[model samples]
Target: MTGGISRVSYSGMLLLGPGTLPLLALLALPLSWVQVGKLNGDVVVQCDTLEPHISWTLNGEQEPMAELVAEGQNLTILGLDLPATGNYSCWAGPVLLDTTYVVVSSTYEEEMDVTCQAESYHGSFHCSWPGPPSAVFRARLTHSDGSVGLWVPVAGGHGQFSVSLADPSFCPFGEELRPLRLHLEGLSDTSYLSLSRHFFLRDIVRPDPPQELTLRWQGEQLHLAWAPPASWQLPKSYFALLYHLQYELPNGTQVERFVEGVEETQVQVGAQRVRISCRDPYTPPAWSPWSPWQDLNAPQ
Candidate 1:
């Protein structure tokens, strides 16, 4: 025994302890591979040995995925966890006999439902879904014109989590009419998502409704006026603001009027109920919410 490796003679059947797991150890192939299932999985691998002693190691490391106390012809791998996914090799009395590549795999579910909506056309959007707390998620915007945003992660899980996108520049004002589409993707070893949410940006227009709607009877002709809605950003100076004025008459006929440049702050009107919302003509089609209904001035 001078600097030489000794080969153990492999023969026939070898018996183990009464409580040992029964595994069929096939010794035909020079190398064998095994795939283990997830979720408290258990699999048996055949090894080349008829002796009452065997040792296992993962990726040829001192730390083995299988315990060393048990020995013989069968190798029982328990609960093939994600970390258990690797090459499993065993040796009988210092002889590299057979190696079993244990590929840990898991089957996933595909029933994640996503609920999303546009919070602000130019600002951002939102989406959420119920998923495994360990599931990984991502979100993005895909324009009909072929433009796409980066895939962002939707953090948190266990039945709930919300992701908010706050970029208004993705689409210019009024592009709200064309709207944008939101695609949410989820990834995990146990779940899948291949769906997206889309809607008319304008349909979700929820800007703070306009305010300061006033009516004054000015010698037969009524005067109506209001200040523009406030904004999160500095007032855009580009477009003179435009207001959509709607009024219901006593006769039941409703009239909608587009008043440009509300700079004058006053208008001659005669109506029962009136509502007003504003938008930038430069950014036409994207309008703020309608102001609360204002009744006609006295003497209506």
Candidate 2:
């Protein structure tokens, strides 16, 4: 967890230091040695050369060569386990040849409880998932046309990880041709896990609450007015919202009403308090959280 691969080139030999390796192998080396093998399975780390002076070390220490099968340039590890997972460096007469980071494939059940939400249809959204405390997660979005996005590093701790992604091709006014694919990978020092999800943006839309709510008294009736959330898409005719109004009567009775295509309404007075929420009528019927309650008699 605290080791990374730092490469320095001197003369012609490649030098690498022990440090944390990234979930994805991005280090530039003479040969790619990052391998993920099944637990208890056999793994072979081969050097680029077949020199007779070839030697191997595990985690900067002298590996028990006698316990492993070292034939010419090939080092074969049998019954791979957690203790066998680490950086395996090949050496030739004090000169570093190459290093291979070996990891075991996790056998734990896949975690699919990932949640995602978008405030608007602007193509950007955030997703979060629960994972092991020692795991590091990275995510990427696969576009509708089979194009894969870059792997975005997740940020979180205490068994949770989250990342934000966007698709520039998303259009709020156009119908979705295909669902977006999310790919996630969780990596630990000794093991790794992967999960994926497919969903349309409309299913996860959850806009912010309505704004600028006002209540005014006109004779024996109360007039209420509010505006859609600023974060919602523009062109009210194209991106319409449905509002839910609720109030409690002085006698402790609650009344609810739905308003659409309008932002102002009048109701009979004597209501103790009033509140409102809104949602897209065409979507999956998920309403935004209710706005704060406003007392009917508190300063207009």
Candidate 3:
């Protein structure tokens, strides 16, 4: 206000000399910012009525600019240089009007280092990366079938983010090992980084154990039926499943059979005990915890 600009106030109106401006407290002003590439960056702060004269500060010190134009009662930083990058505040004889943070960079950035993996088969995964405070982060899921989606956020904001497939149509499993890709990106003040990782859904496919397992006898033949996992969101047509139905004979013989689809399975169920398990025919993932076994009379 002393060596910088002159100001006068009356009837809620502000008056300032040609080279005088407003000085709005940093917190009071809605953080205004401008990002510039190899060319230049301009930051404009508008205040009430009367024309204002303004100067800028870099970080917190005085920084010179090329042009100070009046497009209203506003101050414009029209400089295309690296030194123009910093926190700028305007002053009209010590009455703060507004503040802005100017970012001057070529906008050429490097890909950030990102890594991700499927921690579970229930369509949830985690991706993490270490980035600077001036960076913006985002996550993506690249399905093996070449489909892309903005991954659903789970927890851990900032540098670490978890994602899940909210849409059931985008099945996480297939007839073949699904190389679901995870992509992490970071856009920084002056640069950017992109990172990606691939995972086989089968490796992490741990479906909830099969449900509603039932075994009964229809005269001489045994009838065994079970429903798909309750947690599976997709319809039967969307993905293929492999069921492992097994039984033990009275003499201690263990026999196993594989079934496709959830259509009630009826087999010559003649054994001392019977149990069931299932997997994705594609990831053919590890067998879910075995289902409870049922004891029944041996086939005559």
Candidate maximizing lDDT = 2
Q: Return the TM-score for each candidate structure.
A: 0.42, 0.81, 0.39
Residue pairs in collision within model 1: 25-46, 122-168
Ranking by TM-score: 2, 1, 3
TM-score, model 1 to reference: 0.42
Compose the digit string of candidate 2's lDDT tens values, residues 63-169. 45324677888888877777887778799989988777677777653645899998888899999887767766777899766688987778876678889999877
- What is the C-alpha lDDT profile of model 1 across 1-300, one tens digit per residue? 111112222122121222111324333332222333444566556676665677777666757655333336766666545555445667766787666544333333345566554423455556666765644456677664557777666666655657876544555444544556776654333222345676654454444556777776667666776766654223435435677888888787788878776532334354788888776564326677777788875455
Candidate 3 lDDT at 41 equals 48
Better of 1 and 3 by TM-score: 1
- Per lDDT, what order, best first? 2, 1, 3
Return the clash pairs for model 2, or none: 3-19, 3-20, 4-19, 4-20
TM-score of 2: 0.81
Q: For model 3, how does the per-residue alpha-carbon lDDT over 1-300 read when each residue is reduced to its tens digit? A: 112111211112111112212335323433333323233545454454353565444455554554555554565656445454444566666565555444434323344444443423445554555555445445667765677875443334344444444223344443534567766544333333445676665565655567786666778777777787776546677655688878887679888888887646776655677777777776635666787887756444
Least accurate 10 contiguous residues by lDDT in model 1: 1-10
